[model samples]
Target: MTPAPRGSVRQWLAARPVAAGYILAVGSALSYGTAQFVARIAVTRVAPPLVTTAFALLFGALFLLPLGIGHFRRARRAPGKAWLFIVLAGLTAASGVAFMYSAFSLVPLVVASPLGSVYPLVAIGLTHLFLQRLERVTPRLVAGAALVVAGVVLVVVGSA
Candidate 1:
């Protein structure tokens, strides 16, 4: 199939940032899923989790270093609260990865992976409780969240 006209893709995304965001979210999941598979194998090869985690983080940071450079100036000038939240997000990701790696060592990837997806449920519940400004809860979102939880449960139980 011939590709769309040269600038069509950019125009499409510019027209709908929300849709572009969703597309990127799914794309991240695909890359992240592949990375996790590789990390799982590496962890199994190495006995120590810290060593595995360190190597994973180092490689990831190296790969991201150039991309980070593009934002370095803006990041430096970002508000203190923004920096604080950014650090918090990084710390949260690190904690999750540490636990996930440990879990991979302790359990089957099938089990551990599905269990990890349940983090969204925790995030949703926490937001409902702690985040004062949130979008109105609609039936569509409620149903979608229910399906995600159910699907993760089925995946975990099936793997067991």
Candidate 2:
């Protein structure tokens, strides 16, 4: 088959949301991993973890502000419950970042990075407990979580 046009490729991905989610998730992983590595270097050589965290979070919000501005009106119209959850998510994510940066400052990147990445296991448990109505607990998901845990263990242990 001939190659599709560039816009048609984007349309095709958008029409299949699951595939789009996978692609976006991979992109997020690559970006997050690169940021973590750079943050590790910055905290070790340039500044304290708290300073790094502040700048990183600030720049991150600034970077997204333009993209997010268009959605603010819809966000403001969302229910109070949605606002509460959104605030909680922001706080939780901020805390996670602070803790991870602190960890990177204290230990080797190999150990700290893998330990911080165990969030997927926590996500699986939380989704199983709270989001059952929205998403299913598939065998493949469980196996993937298991493999992630095993990889983290190997990384942490091997570093020691």
Winner by TM-score: 2
**Whole-model Cα lDDT per candidate?**
0.81, 0.91
TM-score of each: 0.84, 0.90
Tens-place lDDT digits, model 2, residues 1-160: 3344567777877677897798799999999999999999999999999899999999999999998899999999999999999999999999999999999999998899888999988888999999999999899999998999999999998999
**Candidate 1 residues 25-65, lDDT tens each?**
99999987987787788778865666787778888889999
Estimate the overall C-alpha local distance difference test score of candidate 1. Answer: 0.81
All models, RMSD in angstroms: 2.7, 2.0
